[model samples]
Target: MLNSNLLRKLDMQDLMVFIAVYQQSSVTGVSEALFVSQSTVSYCLKKLRTSFEDDLFINTRTGMRPTHKACTMYAHVLKILESINLCHAGPATFDPTRQAVTFNICAPEYFEHLILPRLLKNFDFADLPVIVNMHKLETDIPADELRDGSLDLVICFGPNFHRSHPDFKSQVLVEDDLVCVFDKRATPLEPRFSLQAFVERRHVFPTPWTSTTNMVDGWLARQAYKRQIVARANSYSAALKMITGTDFILTLPRRIQKLLAKDTIFNHCEAPNGLPGFTLNMQWSQNSDPDSANTWLRDQVLKACAEQGLS
Candidate 1:
């Protein structure tokens, strides 16, 4: 039933070129994106057409549009490319001290306060050429970005974040409870902050760029209680600064409290009971899990957490 000659006519490189052309929609765009020449793209497209007996892509004023047959074959083509990649993936052996590779990670700004610093310190043990790129954690970080090799790892919080993406494998890095922060000069905490006082005080809440809701506000809403938010800021550092000269209070993760405690201007207490805590987790694409380099990175993170006594 199979045509041996037809099978022989197809090349893996031609399939890859076809995929690039289909996704980019322009010969020039494919060339630029894939680091190939336009002539090469044209030659491949010509071969593809001759084999399939159809013009896979048509040039128009807007861009290169895929023919109906080409549109139907797009998903299959992607799978083929993916299978080829998996087939060619070598064993997961990497030397962090010698391998010249860059690792990209994404996490929230709050992580920059404690976790990130410790993680970076762990990397100092390796004397090899290594580059670490950090990206801001977005609320809607696309699963495809991780799958496509754009990000190596993600450090984030939640009970539900990334639950929808089955391709992401996550491990708990730390569990942190909420704490109430106040200026030592303005708010006097003889023992601990009372629930009544916690709700009555003017709050300086840090609102992340991706969402309007703050962590403290969400917990309060669940209890049918709402604090008087005097102001909202985008950075936790800014919120901490605001409470320094005023009676406003901030409720954030306990790790942050410890990080800022040495400043002496701010003091923190346990957040009132009933408020929810969060789990910080490290996630990586399952496709990258087999790579020895990614395994090394994961181990380093866990080591950092252990050094901080979070494990």
Candidate 2:
């Protein structure tokens, strides 16, 4: 067992430093995040190392990585910090028009394009003096960060949401069907887009999922067919651009077609039969659900969806 005396010497600040270093993997990052000097973070780590009797983090080429012991200790340390935060967090009485607050939300890039404007407009209309931050989301949910309150909300595809995580609650925001965009001038128009024609065309695949594969590919594989993916684009419009004036095709959410239809060269067709549509959902941890600030922030997004007629 660790020496009880040394453990008693460890303070909340030291634990906070430890958690920050673990998450960021850089002393400089922890220093900046915690508003402390690098030396101060180093000093806290030194004290923590003495108490734990282990080098919790080790420097490597990429960054400082947590040791096995440190990895195991992370959950316990996080619980301690969370419990402390709960003790100090009394009833939240907030006024959006008067109180200054910050809301951090993570979602795919298209959400920004489609919903952010309306959300911002609503915020401005109310004269709410608050900061809004939108972070680009990855395929994997940042469950730990959400549970610990670092991430206020997450918006992800329905299939990608971690439904098994009991601590999270989710609501479907929108359901979108896929539409294929290509240069009508170059490719012959068929009333029906056959699966064979779809698999035969060169494709500019949209990504941040996988360079070579995605859900569509998985479906094609199950049917013993696959598309020719020639290039990868991070954005749907970029993918459409690559396929413009050529036989290459880009399949993306139908919502984007109207926005890009002004480009007379491009044409849209319904995705091939048997392909499934997708849904986007808004998710939040139970820890944040009851917070007045988070509730108001969610209201803005819902209003934005209503503006888009996404009921």
TM-score per candidate, chains pooled: 0.67, 0.67
**CA shift at 233, candidate 2, in angstroms?**
0.6
Global fold similarity of model 1 (TM-score):
0.67
Across 134-234, the per-residue lDDT of candidate 1 in tens digits comes to 88777666567789889888887777644457778989888888888888876555456767778988988875435546567777788888889888877
In candidate 2, what are the lDDT values of residues 137-214, reduced to their tens digit?
A: 775777888889888888887665343577798888989877788887755578547899999888888873322346
Candidate lDDT (C-alpha), each: 0.79, 0.81
Model 1 ranges off by over 4 Å: 1-92, 161-163
For residue 72, model 2's alpha carbon misses the true position, in angstroms, by 43
C-alpha root-mean-square deviation, candidate 1:
14.0
State the TM-score for model 2: 0.67
